[model samples]
Target chain A: MKQISTRLSMAVHTLCLIAMLPHECTGDFIAGSVNTNPVVIRRIMGMLKKAGLVDVRPGVGGAYLLRSPEEITLLDIYRAVNAAEEEQLFGIHVNSNIKCPVGRNIEGVLQAEFQAAQSAMEQQLSGVALKQLLSQFKE
Target chain B: MKQISTRLSMAVHTLCLIAMLPHECTGDFIAGSVNTNPVVIRRIMGMLKKAGLVDVRPGVGGAYLLRSPEEITLLDIYRAVNAAEEEQLFGIHVNSNIKCPVGRNIEGVLQAEFQAAQSAMEQQLSGVALKQLLSQFKE
Candidate 1:
């Protein structure tokens, strides 16, 4: 069974908390809620910050929301965390000689198809929002 | 950047070759095509055989395609190779107390989301045929 890493999951959760709390959230507080290390929370927050999703201040202050929950989707968080949306979701190591007919050509074709597949996946995730996830949380 | 491993990629490529070839393919033949150790090919073939994607006959005979190429998808190949689709794609390792509320709750929820995401991805790959992959082969 392939599994989703806690990093992306936790990152989304933290972002959601900030989105939910808006003005009152802190990285330490979010980390507590996520039951993870503060540094880990900060690393993810840094990415979200770069993406203009969140604002963070050093010392004595916590992270704050920059974007509305409605504007953010799971895909936003996913991309923010630097998920591999390109490349095959599974690696197939074929280091065959490029001089060989099948070896030289397969990767390009597979990558093209894989990209299309990932695009579809990103589209699905983009439609799901923090608000939608919160609804699931409420239930 | 988190990336998929080469093992699964090689396995899928190998499978695609067998699917496209005119007759039964052996590990030695596949190894030559893939430029890998025959033992490596057989090891992977063992996994594919267990997944019911291929059938193997020992003693003079090699492996043959049991499942139709069209019936299989990149995702099916992925699953057979034990590629971690949802969790850690590039291998992020973090240990949390499973007894914690966030830890316990997150795994189940995240897993479901990952599975959904993976299914969406799979459906896309499933739409493409190995025969299509054959068109891309060039020396």
Candidate 2:
């Protein structure tokens, strides 16, 4: 089946938790909320940190949002995790017969459409901020 | 990596070839153009046939487009192959901690956003007809 990676969702979830309670945000604690290993949480947090969306201190330090939730869009989280790797999005059969007209040209033919569709999806994602996502979590 | 299924592109390529030359379109011929095993072409053709987008002859026959290329949208091909299974588009982590507020609500919160993003992508796809895609292939 075709699938978008779960990294984008996981990153958003982790960020929402940190935004909700920045002081209580540790890899172990966030992992508890995400129901995954702290290692998994740290991996995603590491990506988020590299993207400047979150900050993680060394040793006993915890994680916190670098930007306000309202300022961070879902697109930010998606890009933070590099989840929009469009080449993989609509896979061209690598072994397509380069000798054949259809095979030779199919990739070029579909590239524009796939890109437009991906852009539309990302634009939709960009419209929703992390703050908006956090607001949906009922107390 | 995040990805959309390639089945949609394959189906479109197969259909474009069939539309361009309906009579000579056999699984072997399509496979030659697609550069995959005839079995793979047949598999996608099977789904397209099931979706009523194409017809495959039983004994000494080949494939043909059921509808004019002008009338078919990328969305039709997508649905034909079940490429848009939303669950696969943005996965919800099965192991999310049920006791946590963020865990309990993350799926619900992201569900709407994911749906909207998916809708936007499909809407973009719906705007482009297969005829337009076919036009992109030179010679």
Candidate 3:
């Protein structure tokens, strides 16, 4: 049971800290909050940075949201951390015996269903903004 | 950028073959259609067998759906193959620092959203039956 990477949740957790405590979001500080190593937080922050969801201030070492919390949906964070994995959320075995009619066409038949199912999950993700998740947190 | 295991799709493909060509579903046959090794087919079939979705004959090595195609939903196959991974489809990072409010509460806040997103995906899967996928395949 290989699980989907934990990067997605870690990215979300990273972003929450950035939103909740912008001044305190140095890599180490954030890593402490995430209960992981600084290197892991740095890696996830790098992805977030590339996605234009967050920006890291150089020299001083702090991060902040590039977009408003409401503008950044869970889908955004999900894509940021897992852009590569999302391209094929559901993988069809490539060498499916082409001789068998069922094998030959199974991939093509399952294609739309996989996409629909992935889209349904992402649709729920897109519905939840980082602001929404942030508001759910208690002081 | 890790992806969910291929076992889910492979299991579905195996089920499709079993339901479509009941008599020819020897492990080798299904493996051929799946374009994978017999061992791979054996592993997936074991999961399906354990779930009681399919029965494997002892002597000659053939498999048949324990339930009709209509009775078997994609969700069942999904569960059969990836039961271990689904317990927490969206895992919250386990070590969030309890000292920080956001870190301490992020897992709890995100729990419902993760469950909802997973449910949306599973809902789509459960809605689709093996019969529906089989009907889409060509002769």
Q: Per-residue CA lDDT of candidate 3, range A1-139, in tens?
A: 5656778888888888898888988999988988889999999899999999999987888889999998999888888887684476777777787777787888887888888888999999999998888877755
Candidate 1 positional error at B134, Å: 2.8
Report the number of the highest-lDDT candidate: 3
Superposed Cα deviation of residue A57, candidate 1 (Å): 1.5
State the local distance difference test value for candidate 3. 0.85
Over B9-124, each residue of candidate 3 has an lDDT whose tens digit, in order, gives 89989888888777888888888788778999899999999999999986887889889888899888888887684476776778788888887888778788898998999999
lDDT tens readout by residue for model 2, A30-122: 888888889988889989998899888879767788898889998888787873444435665556778777777888778878888888988
Could you give the CAPRI-style class of model 2?
medium
Worst lDDT window (10 residues) for model 3 chain A?
A: A83-92
Please say which candidate is ahead in DockQ: 1 or 2: 2
How do all the candidates rank in terms of lDDT, highest first? 3, 2, 1
Tens-digit lDDT track of model 1 for A64-137: 76767788887887777775555345444556757656777767776787777778777878877776666655
lDDT of each: 0.69, 0.82, 0.85
Those runs of model 1 whose alpha carbons end farther than 4 Å from true positions after fitting are: A1-4, A22-24, A83-94, B20-24, B83-112
What is candidate 2's TM-score against the reference? 0.92
Compare the candidates by TM-score and give the number of the best one.
3
